[model samples]
Target chain A: MGSDWKVILCYSITVLYRLWWIPIRAWRLPLKNGERYFQDIEVPEGWHTSAEGRKWWRRYRATIIVPHALEACGLMAIALWGQWKQLPMLSLVAPVFVGMTLAFIAWWRHANRARIQRPQRVAVSLEERKLRTYFSWSLEAALAMLIAASWAIMAWRGDADIHWRWPLTLTYVVIGLIVMKAQVVKHGWALPANRTAEYQHWDEFRRRYASRVLDRMRFMNIVILAGYAAVHSLAGVAPIGAIRGAAFAAGLGLSVWMMIGIARGETAFLRGSARSLLPPATTIIDWKKGWWSFGAFMAGLALLMFWPER
Target chain B: MYLTVDFEDKRPLYQQVVDGIKELIARGTLREGATLPSVRQVAGDLGVNLNTIATAYRQLQEEGLVAVRHGFGAVVKARRSDFAGQDELRKGLRAALTQLVLAGLAEKEIVTMVREELAVVGGKAK
Candidate 1:
């Protein structure tokens, strides 16, 4: 309830919420591409409700459902725990709600992008289709479980009594398992389509654009890591409170900056005038598997959250 | 093995798959006794119905182009020594030529196109 506790709670919730959503965002990049590419197409009558269309509709629904459900369940669990314990953890939920709002705004902007209406049909490469399947079904689900388990286990193990912890833990774990099961789904073609020379060209451009954005993201991460290292290395001489506050501000600033940069970069690339594609289009690594990077981010945040109050 | 499907083409999906695989075989890209990608794999990769890919494989099996063994997926069957399908092949060629002629292709042009395609196949064989 106090300002200091509110700060700590907000910081913890921010890290956990981002960990849950970032992978979903990354994995849905292809689906986003499909939406953008088909934005201007005049599909045949009843295609959206046809068997082929329904298959793709299911994929999009599945893609959106898992992350939204996890966020909802986590919030409900936290709210229930707060009510039962008579705790003032509403501050913790504030930033997460803000994040969801921001995410929705960005998505709305993406959907409204100027439609280029190319004559080519919307098709995914064989490789992209497989990767989407693997991520949605296996990798992302596994990561979500780990995140939920870790959060629940730590919450139970930390200062809370066994009586209170069991219900909270059960709630969290049950939510996690349910979401994981639902996440084990494969995406289908957004449009009934195939790989062609033109599609290959588009894929190559996407890879080039994706790589450039990734390079920038990697640089930002390195800078943030070095900032933390510098702060920790100065712990001996600097006042601990001042050092911690500065480190928190710097880290949070870098994270917000990086996320905005990624969103803007994606938007610009999708709408960019540079239509030239590099030849010999190969299957570009989607980097949707950047869970390790996200893992490192969560680890850093966890370390900060549990840093001893001297 | 690589199997591609073009959804924009006028032909049925299974027929397109069959034609693509047949072309691969004719060019020796898929050699005799070589295994093909599983029906499931083809369907998954192409994002088509499983039954469509199965139908294509069944057609290939019927034509003696590939053998669909239970565990082995499909393998390009070795050319029969007796080779009694020439009449069938000739009939297919005539039908194809007739369609091309109906579509406004001249006889000389059709013959020239056929010769050019055979030459490419012959080159690949050598």
Candidate 2:
């Protein structure tokens, strides 16, 4: 009976967060980088709006919907079954499902690359420049603050076993450091003050592209941070070890899903830009560098956190 | 109709732009009286200089393929009865055939290839 609540809580947060994110992403679709904003694609003669572009968007929405629904249903069923049988491998199932969905998104982008509108170069306005810069630093700071707060709150409550606290703290610290490091990298590679007209044009587009991507990444981080807080808080509320473990696994899986989604988009962008006339301003940041560091950090932290508790 | 310019190609970018638009026009993908993307828009889309697009448009105007106006953008003009440039086309065909023959394509193969190209264009027009 106790485990049932844990499963429910875990699944509810995971599913609801993803459901919420999809609509937000679609609403901001026109704001993303593209040769023409999705909405700006030309319509046929005598038509005021673009019916073809609408169809394309509908297709994109449907593609995303099917995988997301499948993940939710599949993971919910797995979580329930795992709780009943005390299966260890069940925890691996959610990550696998998430991985498949992200891979599908990457493949879909590649397959449709030709059909998709090439990103257009637009003049970056003054207000737009300021807004992007503000969002960049603020979002990074907000995420770090959120993680640190969660760590502190969990420690102060003392309701959950502290045995896992050390590893959790370490995870938070490492993630915080990575976030900070990325900010420094951005600042270091800031667009030069004086540049040729061609380079300037390229830089404007690059900034717009980077800003749009960073905005999406920030939104995903919000989802991930919330997932972490929810699971960590479950310790005191649900005393059952099985239930707590299930919640933890669900939270961890969601984080991986969010990370993978961001990585997939960034990877597609990098690949698409390979043949571009203007490359990114500086050396491109490798997703591998960030993901591998995060992965190794998590693995090490998990060992320390879980082994001691066990 | 999309005008794709390959930055990596050795051919001059402006020439590629002109050729691409002409091909589209010949295939009927871009119909007469259609508005081509504005010079500014093309420059932005291709990440090339504004003058490059202007040069391409100017070449098209010379061929009587497109018309540029002050307020109005470049529009595909109807082909005149004379439809100039047949002599240039013959020259290009001669050069191409000479190369093909040198490369050992038989008379039969060259004729078959020309028919195939015409058929493809005809199919697209339909």
Candidate 3:
């Protein structure tokens, strides 16, 4: 393809790719803490018989399905129509991502308000939580190395007046995510009253995965930031595009890994119910926010590819 | 260690928490220097009031079974012989034996039951 055609084609592919992942909008039942379990994600078997489930479904369209449908259509419009304005895509979507994350934090606090309490015959050992308990050591090492490399590249590429400001701002965001994760795990967390032994095991398993999802979200964010830094630093070089390629590879690779791990669903939950957890697992990603980093990665890649008009 | 606080439990909520944690410490499920979940966390999990959990933690600290640090939650301290509640624990045990006696068990059955109970509670190791 011609150079301009190639650029336009890649940009279109990105926008179209994102639009395709439009929010899954799977209907859920009105069970308290139901989202944490799979039974709530889909129409429960024989749910047409349950008055509560059916009652909630009655409001499903106006309260959920319609509003969500409109929002998705609106976003689709922006993705398609906004291209002509040539607004830097990150500038377009970054605020939305940030707002969604904030919304999530708020929703999390709201949902986590203790709902049930009952005495059980059994006692469980409280597992001491640490960042490493969920996030792996090698992943930690990789993050450290990536940060070091990003700094190294920026130093090698820029003059004495390097743009330290942008990285600093991004660094603050990364720090915020860390604090958010800590807040999430540290909060007064509880289970539904009278959760059975099997349910408790399942909940704990979900929680561990939830914590890992938080770590993975942090890792994904850092990777995207590092990837951006590396490519931007390589602004003058051409063949070094291979190294630029690495950034996309790393981000994309992690997304795939996250996908596989979540896809191989465990516990008694139905298959594909994990789709409801795409954003950050039990922290609750849902469809739109779940593909958030992938969207961010694509936006960065498309922007960088089109930079310099090279 | 898992703890259940039945609303129907006869003991004070704080005492139940204090006893439950002590049992775990005795069992070595919670090792020295291990941190307990924050007061807010325990309160939320058990659906008890925050002050109730805090009171329990303070009692544990007073007894020297666990050390409470600001913002760091409670940490299991090394099992110390200097426990200020040594007599209190003794009285509690005597009360339990009295219950066994009142239940009209044969002396052998009572002795055997106490031993079995000790083993279950990790008191035998202690």
- lDDT (C-alpha) at residue A302 in model 1: 41
Give candidate 3's error at residue A143 in angstroms. Answer: 2.3
TM-score of 1: 0.44
Question: In candidate 1 chain A, what residue range of length 10 has the lowest lDDT sum?
Answer: A278-287
Question: Quick one: best lDDT, which candidate?
Answer: 3
Clashing pairs in 3: A123-B2, A124-B1, A124-B2, A125-B1, A125-B2, A279-A285
Clashes in candidate 2: how many? 5
All DockQ scores? 0.09, 0.02, 0.38
Candidate 2: regions farther than 4 A off: A1-310, B70-72, B79-86, B122-126
Count clashing residue pairs in model 3: 6
Native A-B contact fraction in model 1: 0.02
Q: After superposition, how far is residue B14 of candidate 3 from its true place, in Å?
A: 1.6
lDDT tens digits by residue: candidate 3, A1-310: 2223433443454445334333322233233234433223333456545795455446442344444455456556756774423323334353454444445434433453342122234233365555556556786687778777877877778544445655654555556556555654543233333443444555556666655555665675677768667666776564557755676667666655654454443322433234323211222122433246445644554454444531
The sequence of per-residue lDDT tens digits that candidate 2 reaches over residues A1-310 is 6546645555555556556556755434432434433322322453324675456556556556655566556666766665533332234444444444445444544554454443332221111122334355675687667767756755665445344544354455445445534442232111222232444455444445554544444444444444455455655565546554554665556555655555455445444443333333221123334456645655654565456544
lDDT of 1 by residue, A192-238 (tens): 23335554545445544444444344333333333333343444555
Q: Which candidate has the top score in TM-score?
A: 3
